[model samples]
Target: MGVFLAIPVSTESFGQKSFTIDFEEGNSFTVDFETSFSEGGECCGPYTIVERFNIDNYSYELIEPSFLPIFSTVYISNPD
Candidate 1:
């Protein structure tokens, strides 16, 4: 018979904003992931803004559970 080990992996996103990872077994480590956001102008112009970030992975057991909000807003002047 062969022995097999099952590693538990869990993922959860707080408020649909950020992702949280939990590793049941193995050495503790962190990983960085890429995220992007886009904003549209509300004025008469088609102005937009884009932003990107490399967010680092965080352990759930190390910190308190909280919600992280990720959003972008664009403001433009209306010229008539």
Candidate 2:
């Protein structure tokens, strides 16, 4: 299943970013990117940064969890 999530981020200062997540019942997963880092990984800091999707909003159409190539903590961002 696929859905859209609206996460608002305010990156005005250190530790100032804040956002909310909503998902459908029984179809959401929560993944903490802070704990699952690979050794010598080139990625660091806010692995889940919020990127604006549309000019009027910052939403993302999440692909179904099973279809993903990698595994991570993902939460349902919408209602079922």
Candidate 3:
């Protein structure tokens, strides 16, 4: 439905890592380690569409990272 990613790092490993998510529907955005997804993974949806629209493609530049996801935790944490 959407996309989310988090990279855990210690102060020692912290650096200026970056990434970009390009949507087929368009609102492409870039994120970095300092700003991280602490901003957001903007979702493009009508949600009740006849079918579905999703992340077109994504790429990231990490300096030895951890994990990723198909929707942010905020989407999970706030069900309203």
Best model per lDDT: 3
Score candidate 1 by lDDT. Answer: 0.28
Consecutive 10-residue window with the lowest summed lDDT within model 2: 30-39
Residue ranges of candidate 3 with Cα displaced over 4 Å? 4-14, 34-80
* Predicted structure 3: clash tally: 0
- RMSD each, Å: 19.5, 11.6, 17.3
lDDT of 1 by residue, 1-80 (tens): 32232322223311112333344554233322232323334763332221222334322221211211323221222333
Ranking by TM-score: 3, 2, 1
Give the TM-scores of the predictions, in the order they appear. 0.20, 0.24, 0.28
Candidate 2: TM-score? 0.24
> CA lDDT of 79 in candidate 3?
35
Model 1 spans > 4 angstroms off: 1-16, 26-50, 57-80
lDDT of each: 0.28, 0.30, 0.36
- Report how far residue 47 has shifted in candidate 2, in Å: 15
In candidate 1, position 70 carries an lDDT of 22
Candidate 1 vs. true structure, TM-score: 0.20
